[model samples]
Structure formats: structure tokens, C-alpha cells
Target: MTTLFSTMPSAVAPAPAADQAVQDSSPSLPEMLIAWSARDEALTARSARLPGVAYWLREVAAARTEHERALVRVVNQHGWPSVDLVGDEAATAALRILLHGQDHAFLLRCRDLIAAAVEDGACSQVHLAYVVDWCLVRLAQPQLYATAINPALGRPYPVADPDGLDTRRNEMCLPPLAQELARHQTRRLAS
Candidate 1:
């Protein structure tokens, strides 16, 4: 299975120190990577039970473009309500276009899917993360939460309408992802 964990950075945060503590000890990009890698085992276990999704994953891996493979991997890893609920082959194809093809209208579609799939709790967090990740990638950015400090401090950002959301250009309201990226940049600048 594609498993959401795979798309995460390979090096996550380090163990907490006995003497060091804070209210928000957010993981750095490297730390996030580590955590993501460790979760690979979880994805492996989950993949075994979802065969159809597995088949799509293989196809995605075999696809000609990086974007196609990335989309397939993402869907496999984070998709919810099961592949059956994602709809028939047509819906899957549409999802592929929305995700990989960089179709913005499809983001709302993906969100709708998420809303239906995840009622609440941890699964919802994962689903939203996936959607946010998709948006970040489409904008040629990095994964969310890797450098995030306070995710709860903001209003929800707006996504472009896919059908009307132009593919010829990039939109705005990427502040959330931008904040994370800026923190990483600032750290590098300081060093």
C-alpha cells in the first residue's frame, strides 16, 4: 500500500530531553521525517487489508510522471471511507487528475471526501493532513506539520475552486504552509 507515512520526511524529531521542556515542542523537519519513517510499519500492516488500493498503488508507482506516482501514493496512504467509497474507476481517475494534474477544483472534492470519511478524532486529523499535503505539493512546497509550531492558531485557509481554479497559475492563501517553510528558512539563515 502507498501508506500516508511514506510521503512524510525520513528524519523526524529526536527524543525529548530530561532537562529541556516546552509548551510546544514541535518537531523539526528532520524529526518529522523520523516519525514518518517509523510509521511505515503501520502503513505496511494497513496495506495488507486493502487490496484494490494496493493495485492502484502499483500502477501509480509504474506511472510515467513523478506527479502521478505521488498522487497515487498519497491516495493509498491517506484515503479514507475506503477505496469503494472513493467511487468507481472514473472517480479514481478524476482524483488522480485533481491530485497529480494539479486541479484545484478537485481539492474541494477531496475535502468533501474527507468530510464524509472522517467523522472526528485522529483519523480526521490524518485526512486533513493529507489534503493539506496535497495543496502544499501542488504549490511545489513541502509537507505540513514538519515545521509547524502552532497549527491551532489560525482560521482555515481557502482553497481555489478546481473547475474554475486556473491550472495555468498558482493561487494564494498558502500562509499555513508558508509559515512552516519560513521557520525552516529562518533556522537555516541563522545557522
Candidate 2:
């Protein structure tokens, strides 16, 4: 149903021809991030009420596939698009996509980039913690920090030190694990 961009703010302008040219030349990080966000939002909304809708699911999957391809192109052109290159917001959004992506190798590359970005004070530790936890979980290793939440279970994934999770989370500007877990539990109960 509803079009994804129907409610988009009027202030956001359509991409210009020159911007399209740049994207055609190579994957534009900011543009791709924006597209990913729109598609992700659409998928989230539709999936919540129409879980069995194959068409919507296919559309979302196609969008994700496009994002993955664009990510590869961006990486090929430049190791990773830093905040300096794509701006802080776009870089953060790009990192979010990679964190949730299925390609472990690509995620690892993005993780290294995020680490460097954090060192340069270009990105936040909060973002880095998510990717780190996701990578650890993907590798079947315990997460050092409990940043990755298990959506289905409505809780944080397995952590190396549950007791120390909140300490590490606090260092990364994240809320305490107990507090987050409680919030998730509350939401589950409500649902």
C-alpha cells in the first residue's frame, strides 16, 4: 500500500541530474543511505501488518540487494566512505546498513572503517559497539559489549560478561543493559 515517500518532508528536494551523474559514476554514499532508509522504513511498516505479503517482502529484499551492491561499489572506489567524505549523518546511516547486512566480510571491513572514524572523532562509539556486537554474534563469539539486541527474543544477544555489559555500554554512551532489557520486556508484555 502506502507509498513510502508520501509523507516525506516537503523540504527534501529530489536529487539533481548532477547528483545522479555522480551516483552513476560510483555509488554515492549519502544517496544510497537515504534510499536504504526509505526502503527499510517501508519494509518495517508493511511487514508489521502484512508478514505474509510476498510482493512487499520481495520489494524490500530487492532494495536491500541494491544497497549491498552499492556498498561494494563504494568500497571499491574508496575503502569506506568516511564522515569527511559523506558527512556524519550519511556515514552513520551507511554504518547502520552494514551492521544489519548479511555479508560478514563487508561488515568486517565497515567495522575497521568505523573504528578509524571513532579514533578520528568522526563517528560515535555507540555506532561502533553495534557493529562489533553484530560481528561477534555472526562469528558465534560472545559479544564484548551488549549492544546488539535480538529482535525476536526482545533482549540483548549473548554477551561475554553479562555483569560487565552495562559498564561497557555506559562507556559507549548506551543505556544500562538491565534498563534496555527491561524496556524490551515491557514492550513484549504490552504486545
| Among all candidates shown, the one with the greatest TM-score | 2
Q: List the residue pairs that clash in candidate 2.
A: none
* Cα shift from native, residue 23, model 1 (Å): 50
For model 1, how does the per-residue alpha-carbon lDDT over 104-129 read when each residue is reduced to its tens digit? 65575566666565454313333455
Please provide, for model 2 over 1-191, each residue's C-alpha lDDT reduced to its tens digit, 9 standing for 90 to 100: 56765454533233222223234334455766666655565565566567786766665665566666666667666666677777777777677667656788888888888788889987788888988899999998899788777887776788997778778888998898878789878865764
TM-score of every candidate relative to the true structure? 0.25, 0.76
**Model 1, backbone clash pairs (residues 3+ apart or across chains), number:** 15
Off by over 4 Å in 2: 1-31, 182-191
